[model samples]
Target: MTNTHIKTLTAAILFVPLLAFAAAPGSTDSIETRHGRVDVIADADATHLLVAGKKIATLGVGSASLFRITSAAEREYIIVQGSRPGLHCHYSYRLLALSDSGPKVSKEFGECLDLGGAGMSGAEPVVHLNSRVDPEAGVETYQWQGDDVNLVFESPTLCGATGFVAQKNAAPVRAPLASRVKGSGRLQFLSAPDAGCAMPGVFVVPGDKVTATLASAAFVYASYTNPKSGRKVQGWVPRERLSDL
Candidate 1:
């Protein structure tokens, strides 16, 4: 082949893939899935989710910043995250499951500060949703079952604040009260009341104030707020590790 012809052919070959994969002005990169390629296209007024060129769902005026296909227990799903319409601090998410008929929205959450970390928990797909207005509400855990979405857990928010308080049972051995961490060592925070629940790596040193609620025989739900960062974390702490203050 002539030198000019060979150069032209090489350039055309390199440009083909770019044309095939390049997203339109207002769309996210395509998410390849077993069912098909998933995409979120945004226009002046709304954003649309499409699978294999078939429209699956739509959101109000917003731009999709996240789009991906994930699987759990052998089932495939599409997760989309974006800003909530007319809200600067809030975001929204849509969860869709793939089927023989195509992909369909199973759950939709709005007015969230963030939604991400799509992963697997045993046979279930898990995601975290944090509230924009309620910092004390902490992060919410959601799991997918077939085509449905379930709220499996809500992490504890800051103590002394009027927000979500996880209750393991109808009644507590001790009523909610202000308390302080005991001992010179750090007290670890657990995700649940049970010791088997994973520790969230949060700790409170001696004299750190905490609001103890939902007390069981051995454990008490404690919420601790960092004075400087204003960050909060709540979880179960052994009842013996705290002292009434």
Candidate 2:
């Protein structure tokens, strides 16, 4: 055999193993061969990044193919990494495994429909707010679980306020509505008086943080009311106590 042929064959044998070894530690092709068939496949129909069949990160890819295996907290993740040398820019993908599990555990307003049989008045999933206000303490709220909660609290009072579960990155993670909403919408805010801030209740669905704009535009309206502020008013309720809201 020609020297060139021998050199090429040697390079091929060495390179192939190195590539598969980097896929995942203790998951080398050689190791897998010692066990059984290696299942690394790229499902083109899938919405994720995959290298040699294992899913990697998948967020965005612009004709540039780059993916890696990143480790985190004893977990192995197929990570996607890409950069344009000519364009001098980089990109990444947020690839994920499609679950064979049924449509995620969904929650509906029907579950939280009656606020667990709580006497919440006004339109279902909606309450009417006249020019008046509720003098009693505790604010109005609705929810099934943290995951599927669609809370909206607002007051027209100069002390007018608004609150609800604010959503962060709407990554569709496989989880029950309750578990998914943890650490989400934990914060609260109040609208400037001039903004006529209307906190509308939301019709939330599990795994639906996407297509959801927690921005100024996504503000739902619970109802409309007017709390004469500049003018005289009843004694103030302590901030700690929501008696005035």
Candidate 3:
């Protein structure tokens, strides 16, 4: 109940740790009930975890950590946490955004960028994003959502920077596509030929179902299908291809 949280940034494939989390059956302390998917880092990068909107823990951890994404009833919870066997750590890990340095709660990170004026993380909180950027006009800046996913926009004079999300206090008929819209990126609209892009070692666009391996950086532009969302448009495909984004 202490509400302690941490943020970190590191460079690793998105689901490598998830693979381990899914495989470890011997550790009774192993994490279960992951709603989405996650990655864990160690060492000096642990400084990113924050609690109650304040910096709390660092990467100084020996206990096992778990990354989980839990979605239920139109809600998704992407989580990264560490725990001992029934030992209370006093922190409820919540991701402000995934970054390369690690989980981040600092305002300098994209999780704290202009961030629109939407209310989030208080009630049935959800972080929605659909911001369009134009690089030719010098708009794209740095985006850090943990350590493995920090990016500076390279596409210039582009579109699809629509950052929008919807919330309802009363039961309403129209359900907002906030998750789909906020998660959608303009890049997915890019036309892909048999091959991908040639941004001079800048980005490797995936043509079909691809894998995000370690040390691999690809600015993927893809259109995907989700049972929850109709047709997700564009988003920087996670080197891990997170969902239909």
Q: By descending lDDT, how would the candidates be arranged?
A: 1, 3, 2
CA lDDT scores, all candidates in order: 0.57, 0.22, 0.27
C-alpha lDDT (0 to 100) for residue 227 of candidate 1? 97
Expressed as tens digits, the lDDT of each residue in 80-106 for candidate 2 is 222222442333222111222211111
TM-score of each: 0.51, 0.20, 0.21
Deviating ranges (above 4 Å) for candidate 1: 1-25, 67-69, 85-89, 131-134, 157-245
What tens digits encode model 1's per-residue C-alpha lDDT throughout 8-123? 11100010111123233465667777778777787767777788988877766367754443343345665566665556665666676766676667667635556423444334
Per-candidate alpha-carbon RMSD to the true structure: 15.9, 23.3, 19.4
lDDT of 3 by residue, 152-216 (tens): 33222112111111111122223212222223332232221111211222222233332221121
Best by lDDT: 1
Q: Between 2 and 3, whose TM-score is larger?
A: 3
Backbone collision count in every prediction? 1, 19, 45
> What's the residue-level lDDT of 70 in candidate 1?
37
